[model samples]
Target: MISKRHADILKILDSSGTVTVAELANLLGVSTETVRRDLRPLVEDGAVHRMHGAVSLTGPTAEAPFRRRMRENAPAKQAIAARVAATILDGQTVMLDTGTTTSFIARALTGHRRLRVVTNSMDVARTLAVTGGNRVFLTAGEVRPDSGAALGPAAVAHVLQFRADVAVISAGGVDALAVTDYDPDEAEFARALLTCAPRRVVATDATKFGRRGLVAVVGFDGMDELVTDAAPPAVIASAMAAGGARLVLAG
Candidate 1:
């Protein structure tokens, strides 16, 4: 029988690829010995792998597809979303690009009323459209089956039609040079959305720190703020300082 504690451990591993045993013990409010006892059966069954002082998911369960990315670093993404949502007021217009972090942001904004949302993510649209007395404009474009994001020229043109109070985007990577994306169409669409808002915010998790993606979305100079779960590397921090973009660390 899987105890509730066992289930909680799996959930944590699903969100964070690896975690120290001490961290898990702290999170579960148990002693290290207890955690070890709970992990024994799970390890024996090959549901999780044990490192010297940490644990991680095993085999195919560790793979991160788009849907899996939604689960990855979930707590960090949620914290980032909460920080971004705190800056947005009710009845404000928000522009968002498609990405897993932005999808988290959409859920965070559900409490706000009368929000005008413009987005190219079907997930974002579906999340905010039904609740909050908000009006959501979903762009028409070539929808990627993997992410349910509308991309390409049509999406860019659709986003260009509206100006917003704020634009929140997600990144595949954030290095010293720029914020970047894995897909060219996603990058192009994000660039267009950035132009539509005076306050452009990039929300990414700590795992993206120092990674370089295939396509450049924008340099720090192009954005007003960068929000993440942890402090960036010194080089990336220096670049953001040089570019005059505020760095917001999510609590």
Candidate 2:
């Protein structure tokens, strides 16, 4: 029941996480007004969400499903997680948000002992809870089936109650300007987690470079470290320098 234009729009959004009205029009070879018209029914059908001036598969389908996302860039994510895990000391309280990369990070923490792991991700909670020496806390909130993440006001409030030594997060995009997310509520939830933690780390792969999202979780300055499989583009280097963020490239 989807039109060709709608199908193409969804395809682009799936690959890049977000696309603006003007950008879509140019890519589709249609007028801006025409592209807007095409987006109306798609948005109504719960196929996508419109935010600010762009459209993305947000809300329930913020990125991709858990199992599918776990396979996407699996190797890169594991490397990033391993590098992130290496920086953590035993007995440290670490916080993480819901995302496949963070799930990998949780798996990487299994070897550490007596650590407290707090997360809004059901998968992350389950992964670490069964580990022999780690204590896991799953926050109270509405769990979105699509992402298996606890988000919204209640989750943010719950995160405020716990202060962490480090917070590991993932993003739809790590733009030259800021770290962004396609879901607004998730972005706010991440912002709350960042504020509650003394050190904040962002885990993402190289594909996120130059991508766009509906909302920015934080500016570059808010990130204490960025762990990825490859080095960032030259454009981000200036921002990292100005923000005092250390870039850690994993193997």
Candidate 3:
């Protein structure tokens, strides 16, 4: 038998499809930490899916729903974003990939003095577009409504025009062999960015470790840097050593 709190959580997730940790905490008259603890079992039981700071009834799939992903592990993502933003030089061109972590990076880049950003994420483009001293370019392609990302042959072509100083992308997983993505089109776009930039940087949280997606975007051997909230597993560490990729831990 489940606890009343667990039952309530399931009820909420079922009705709304998704809810944030803070929202659940508030509604349940508990602390955020408590809500997190409450969610672990449900997640293990496959009764709930935990995104950054949010929860949903659906289990982990090829792609997490966008809103839930944005709220999932938000603080860790922010930390990773700030680290990614700090390394970018002023007035340099950057290729931004589509993902919640990259969206946070876009927000972090708002204070940068000058930059040229080419991206397929509508969320990323919108976040930095209005910021002063920044030039934002949005790719043309079919937009995934939930993710707000443009991905297709047209988008890949648009991204290929710029030879960026850095390519900051997000990954569904960073395992021993490759960096992967849930969507094939998104993976293709990411690979295009990787080829166009000398510095290939992947920004993702620790939760992404060991999780593989439907397609591989780039192999571990091709990565230049990885920014994350925790130290990678031994397999990843070994791969990084063999590939000469630098790992940046945000915390």
> Per-candidate TM vs. native?
0.76, 0.82, 0.76
RMSD of each candidate relative to the true structure: 9.2, 3.8, 8.3
Candidate 3 clashing pairs?
A: 51-72, 52-72, 52-73, 53-71, 53-72, 53-73
For model 3, the stretches where C-alpha displacement exceeds 4 angstroms are 1-64
Q: Per-residue lDDT for 1-251 in model 2, tens only?
A: 23999999988878756567867888899998999999999899889877666777755656554565677788999999999999999999999998889999989988888889889999998988887688988998999976789998999999999989999889878878999887898899988899878899999988777766779998888989888999888988788878989888998
> Against the unseen true structure, what C-alpha lDDT does each candidate score?
0.89, 0.86, 0.85
Q: After superposition, how far is residue 200 of candidate 2 from its true place, in Å?
A: 1.3
Candidate maximizing TM-score? 2
Residues 1-251, model 1: lDDT tens digits: 34999999999988776666766889899998999999999999989877545677776646634566788789999999999999999999999999999999999999999999999999999999999799999998999876799999999998999999999999978889999876789999999999999999999999888666778999989999999999998999999999999999999
TM-score of 2: 0.82
For each candidate, how many residue pairs have backbone atoms clashing (under 3 Å)? Answer: 0, 0, 6
Candidate 3 lDDT: 0.85
- Of candidate 2, the 10-residue stretch with the lowest lDDT total is 58-67
Write the number of the candidate with greater TM-score, choosing between 2 and 3. Answer: 2
